[model samples]
Target chain A: MIDNTMNPFLIFISACLINNILLIKFLGLCSFFGLSSSIKNSVGMSLAVIFVTIMATVVSWIIFHLVLVPLNLVFLRTATFILTIATLVQIEEMFIKKYLPPLYKAMGIYLPLITTNCAILAVAFLNIDYNLNLLNSIAHGFGVGVGYTLAIILFAGLRERLMTAPIPKALQGYPVAFFLASLMSLAFLGFKGLFGL
Target chain B: MSKSNKPGISAPGTAAFLYGVLKGNPVLVLMIGLCPVLAVSTSIFNAVGMSIAVAFVLIGSNVIISLVRKRTPGEIRIPVFIIIISTFVTIVDYVIRAYSPELYRQLGVFIPLIVVNCIVIGRGEAFAYKNTVKLSFLDGIGTSIGFFIVLFVIGLLRQLFGKGELLGKVIFSKPALIMILPPGGFITIGVLMGILTYYNLKKSKV
Candidate 1:
């Protein structure tokens, strides 16, 4: 377990770089590979992911620490947290549509997809598993979002360039994209010892 | 490739089973269950363990969903599907923890993350809900077999290359560390897909 006094900034940076949720930890990759075809759409997806992950982490933290632990219902964590996230996505959809129409138009469809994205749930479980404080949990969640954003954006850029390259018939679409992901993961691994966390 | 046999028109058990193994392979073809494919494919043992666990969940969820397909309201079907799926996932999680503590420790959160695995819920929603119990069960088995095969191959390569061993027996003096890392998983799957595509294209042309 990390010390309780560990700096939130360090947690955030480490999550974003060294322990990148997508490249390093290999979470939320379905959407990462699926939605990284374009920069604009990937940015939208990342923003929605950022919002949903932070909210889900904070909410799951409170539920785990205050409710499940006390009631000895930790077993219900998987079902309850998923249901909560699903409901949260629904409510978030409605709320965005009603008050923030423009924002809703931008990220409305992507919001529902967030429920299935493993990164949110992964972050929620990780926060508890690491025994992080409330602030650290939020920071970690935010950092994961940023890391995901970084990965997707960079991947989108590479893919955009790959569009023009004369690729072989066999490795045209997904295979090539995955190779790109492997290289990116390789690059991200270099950050492992930077902070020594 | 028979003209007379079309999906939903004829209910062939073998057909459905074989379809999942090749045509509708969850990992290589459908690309649904990449999370477990990437995270747990570090070794052949982990690959088999994760496959069995997922296979159990997939079979259970498919059977139950097919049984209650008529009764479940359309509006609430997704949640109902989720509840059933998570119940099975929880069962597998506890069973693993009690019987195999070391495997459970290695899998850690991934056991629970099975709840969100697209393949399980994908089968529940796509095939089981509309198909009969027998067909759904067969589909579950076939899909899991496909998943297991791909995972095993990837794990085999990774373990053999990464650690210079197979199931803890050293095969080489120098192991490539990248083969077991996250990047190795992506590269292996990517190259495998490329080979599959190559063969698929060749077959199509012929």
Candidate 2:
């Protein structure tokens, strides 16, 4: 078990930089690579992820601590949490489509895709694995979302510039994108000893 | 587009199997379900463990989803598939924990994250949902082998360079420790992908 007494601020920084969900941990790469081709799409997807991940952390934490634990049904965590996230994404999409029409138009397409994003599920699992309380879990979730946004936005910007650069046909598309990610990942490694995390 | 009229075998079945292993490899060609590939591939041991676990879940879910495809309602097929896939993942999670605590610890949350792996669910929706049980089984095997092949190669390279060893045997004294780090994973995979694309492009031209 991790030390629960660690400050939430440190947790935020650690998750955001030291252990960035996309560049460092490699979670959510499908969307990281897919939606990151354009800055507009990446921003929309990141906004949706930020909304969904925090909500998921809150709900899953509550369920695990209150329901799954008391009922001794901890074995069902995987299935239960996935079902909850799937349902939540659906409800959130519907709610947004109804109330926030403009917001829905902006990020509506990415909601359904978020259901299978490993980052959201990984966040929920990490919250439980690290033994964080509700406040810390929320902080961690937000930090991870911000981390994802930062990486994807930066990546999209680079990819935009890459589109016009001369390149070998073999390395034209994803290969170059991956090499770019490798460089960014190497750069992000500089954050490892930050705050002695 | 060649159709097989040979007795006791079908062309589509062979095509399905070959597609996963070569044409539509989950890792190399399609680039889906890459989280585990990059995360646990620092060592061949962890890579093999992850491959086996994912293979089991993929095969199990594929077979079961193929079996129930006809009866499943079209509107809710995605949820149904998720449930089936998660069940197998949960089972694999405990089995690994009970049998090999070391592997379980090394794999950690990745075992559970397999539930969200795009390959398993993608296969269930794309191939298994419309194919016969036997063909789905073959597809599962072929896809697993493809996944295993890429994973094994990455693991081998990373282990050999990172630790100057292979499967716990020291091959050399000096090692590039960065090969085992996160950046190493990205760089190795990037180079590998570039090589694959180069070959494919050459093949097509020829």
Candidate 3:
């Protein structure tokens, strides 16, 4: 397993490009498709995801290693991790509403969806699955978020252009968007084995 | 589109089941659980396995949530629903792992992801919470059948074209390898959705 000895820098890059959470791992496709209809919303969603993934991954790591593993409660991971994420998202929402009113108004709408954005939960599980240490897990989380932002933003840009392009009536909305995703997935596959991670 | 969101008359079991199959087909219409649809539909075996697992979880969660709907406080209802759904998911996950280890291995992360499938929780919040236990049970089976129909078709096509096999039996001499890859999943679902949308539009026009 590349978990223990993999360098942090390499982990960051690999997670971003080589193993993108959306195109490759398919962790968070819901928002990738749902929010990518517009660049602004996609970027906003990505920012929210970046914040939540880092926090959720780190916290889940602590809970899994310090609490679950020690107490032989590993089976509770699926339940516990999701509960932790739900709570974290709730807290983040409350905090934003309390102090960062402007940010709340801008990105608050996407925060509630984060609780169900499999990417955050997926990252939490991946951290444990990969057996990454605390630092590595955080790096991986950040990498997944950055990769998601990069992919969604790029997609949003393409979609903005697609709006003007002539499309068949049947393929107007999601069908065309899905075809675009396939092309993107095909391109992303090129990054496979790039760093051999 | 309006029909998809309108609550089904859960009292009539067949009506509830048909509602799921045609109007609220989870994949083509509501698009609730596309992750599993796209990820596990590469083969018939995997597709059926996933659908059954989802059916088990959905039925179990729906029945349980309905039975306790009155007691499940609104403030913590979502969390309560998540825990209940995850419990069923965990059970299915272990059962699959124990008996059909191969299918479980093939499914990988998706089995666990079932805990978070929007359709299960979506139905719970939308229908089960407001309906009776018997109706919720039928609704679960209805939606599962609908989901199964989509999964089965996609799996059959993907396996037939992508691997030149159906349920592990050879169908074609040469298969289109791309049909089974991630992109293939997207393209298939996209085209299928397009066809379904076009048909529905034509049907509604007359």
Candidate 4:
């Protein structure tokens, strides 16, 4: 049952909206809390992450299957995957700078900030760490990254709006954001049934 | 190396270690790493196991990151950092699985999720990368203790009110189911954060 079409699609939607890596899984809380202050940066950071994640997933899959597995070096899976991601992020930064300098400036510190984002590293590890083939991994990368984007965008949209919303004095910043996350996680609890797939 | 103060101990090393456990306060001051704190604190046993596992990653990764911090070019530091952090995570995962499958199952996906816990990488980047090994080790202990303190409190509350017991002892038969569920975690952490903020504010005013 190596079905990629429907399963991948479901996985994407579910990961994005339901089992959101941020709200539920709590994968990349650092970036979620740190970079999500402004909607503009959130959008840029989200897209850059989505872009690099697809690339990292593809490359890491290849390395895991072709190099690590063959050499009895599976023990080094996490190390290799992370280093490769770091290297790929470097490549991405340079490529963006040379090719998309304008867009690069728009992304700003988030470009480098993505390096520490555990979500990015988590995706890389999941691609091979969970033993998905190239296609499955790609679907996962797309799914999880979109899932990340959706949550961040949604949160950013709300938080951006909240900038004007009358939040209580104590609950203004992280407090309110956390409360929202808690509620969102509760809302996401509705999606556990989709796992019937 | 850690035991004998003269072997590799230094002053700043002492500071970072203690800071992580208490002052920097991964659970309170840093106010990050709350995911595991909430999710895994449903039981006292889980809090204990997770804390130990986190301590191992903090110590090993902190030391390794500090050792390589200088050579890691600024442009590529982040990636290099991930590689290092993920490596230690994998090693811990394997060691844990081999020796302790029960704890592994209880931790569930969180053991792997440690790859992303900012406290581990945060300590690496913030303290370990610049300090000595001994100090990094202490930082690991301190941070773990802080995490342990937070998790223990949450676990105690959840196990008490949610399960009618502290560690399955059945202190009271009628427990609140909501307290053990996910929302309960948020509520508890929220109140805890408020109290911490209140204390911090009061202390500052003094």
Better of 3 and 4 by TM-score: 3
10 residues in a row with least lDDT, candidate 3 chain B: B1-10
- The residue pairs in collision within model 4 are A16-A147, B13-B135, B17-B138, B17-B139, B20-B143, B21-B142, B21-B143
Off-target runs (Cα >4 Å) in candidate 2 are B1-11
**Fnat, one value per model:** 0.77, 0.71, 0.48, 0.29
Best by TM-score: 1
Candidate 1, residue B192: the lDDT equals 99
lDDT per residue for candidate 3 within A1-197, as digits (tens), equals 33858988888988899888888677788778888989999978988999999999889999999999999989888899889999999999999999999988788989988887877887887788788999999989999999999999999999999999999888888889999988998899888777776
Candidates in order, TM-scores: namely: 0.97, 0.96, 0.96, 0.85
- Clashing pairs for predicted structure model 2, backbone only: none
> If both were scored by TM-score, which would come out higher, candidate 1 or candidate 4?
1
Docking tier of model 3: it is: medium
Superposition-based RMSD of candidate 3 using all C-alpha atoms, in angstroms:
1.8
* lDDT of candidate 4 over B31-144, digit per residue (tens): 667667877888888889898888888878887877777787777766666777777788788888999998888786677677667678777766676676667777778888
lDDT of predicted model 4: 0.74
Q: Can you list the residue pairs that collide in candidate 1? A: none
What C-alpha lDDT, on a 0 to 100 scale, does residue B77 get in candidate 1?
A: 94
Worst 10 residues of 2 chain A by lDDT: A1-10
| Candidate 2 C-alpha lDDT tens digits along A68-141 | 99999999999999999999999999999999999999999999999999999999999999999999999999
DockQ, each predicted model: 0.60, 0.58, 0.58, 0.31
